[model samples]
Target: MLYIIGLGLCDETDITVKGLEAIKSCERVYLEAYTSILMVPKEQLEKFYGKELIIADREMVESQSDEILLNANSLNIAFLVVGDPFGATTHTDLVIRARELNIPVTVIHNASIINAIGACGLQLYNFGQTISIPFFTDTWKPDSFYDRIKENKDLGLHTLCLLGKKIYEPPRYMAINKAIQQLFEIEETRNQKVYTTESLAIGIARLGSSTDQKIKVGTLNQLLSQDFGPPLHSLVIVGSRVHILEIDFMRFFAVDKQLYNEIVKKDYGI
Candidate 1:
């Protein structure tokens, strides 16, 4: 049997009881490292789980999956993923491939940023399409995501922007500042005025980590100057038709509550 386990957000202890049992019974355990990461290091997880893990980078998972799936017909194999196993489409593809090989699969689900972003006090149902903001290069800046955000805005729905991360290389994590800058640049080029410097946004850093998590709510310009200490940050673009309750709840995390209120009233007309 092949087990695809979700490690949840945060550290090793965040694994579900069923996932831990599966890990203990598995003959070989592979940790998928490229999609997202845990708050703790590999060694920490190994120490906690009492199992040595083989790190599966993007290359190995995509190009050499058969090697990882080897012997799964006879022996139990575990493929661990940060957040939920199905969070990334790559993992879904792997499951499809396993089915083609007639390998029985078991999935263990857990909390991911997709749902956990509600900590910012935004209603999950009110969110439109979720978009990923990739690290922009001088020659290749993509604004396709901006159109999605605009679509969400047009419908009075919030937009969740999942920042990009480059793992196994120099390790680049997109900051909220850079995301806002890219959005502004896209607006300048497109001139649709989907977003502006005074637009309200919420920046979350190191989410699900008890010790280092931070939440900041303010305008795009206000957040650009704030320092969100560590990696794994996400940005939320506030829709113009925000609920009063959401504004009230998120005000606690606002950089300046008065300013947040003023902007919400003036720009969002809430």
Candidate 2:
């Protein structure tokens, strides 16, 4: 049997009871290290899990999965994912390959940033599409994400912009400030007025961890200057459909209370 388990967001202790049991039963356990990461170190997770974990980078998972899946038909193997197993399409491809090899698979579900972003007080149903903002290069800047944000704005729906990271060559993660700067540059080039300095945005860092996680609500201009410590950040572009209850909840995390209110009322008309 091949088990794909979710580690959930944050530390090693976040794994579900079933996931832990599966880990204990498996002969070999591999941790997928590229898509997302946990707050604790690999040693900590291994100590808690009581199993030696093999680190699986992008190349190993994508190119050399056969080795990882070897003997799965005769023995139990565990593939651990940082968030929900299905959060990334790469895991789905793994399942397909496993099935083709006649290996039985089981996936253990857990909380991901997709649902956890509700901590910002935005309604889940009000969100349009989730887009990823990749690092822009001098010769290869991508503006496709801008269109998704514009579509969300046109529908009065919120947009969740997940910051992208390269596949662990240098382990660089996009910060909230950098993401905002990239968005502003995109707007400057396109001039669609999809978003602006006065547009409301929420910058979140270290999500799912109770201690280090930071959630800040303010305009792009307000949040661009604020410092969000550490990596693994996400940004949310507020829409016009924000509810009164949401406004009340978000005000607690605003950079400036009065300014947040003014943008919501004047700009969002909510």
Q: lDDT (CA) for every model shown?
A: 0.88, 0.90
Candidate 1 local distance difference test against the native? 0.88
lDDT score for residue 81 of model 1: 92
Per-residue C-alpha lDDT of model 2 across residues 147-252, encoded as one tens digit per residue: 9999999999999998876665645789999999999999999999999998999999988898899999998998899999987899999988878899999999
Candidate 1 ranges beyond 4 A from true positions: 166-171, 268-270
- Point to the candidate with the largest TM-score: 2
lDDT of 1 by residue, 1-270 (tens): 999999988988889999999999998999997777787899999888888999988888878889889989899999999998766444866787789899999999988888899999999999999999888899999889989999999998999999886644544689898888888889999999888898889999988888888999999999999999878899999886678898889899999989987987787667
What's the TM-score of each model vs. the native?
Answer: 0.95, 0.96
Candidate 2: worst-modelled 10 consecutive residues by lDDT: 164-173
TM-score of 2: 0.96
Q: Candidate 1: worst 10 consecutive residues by lDDT?
A: 164-173
Best by lDDT: 2
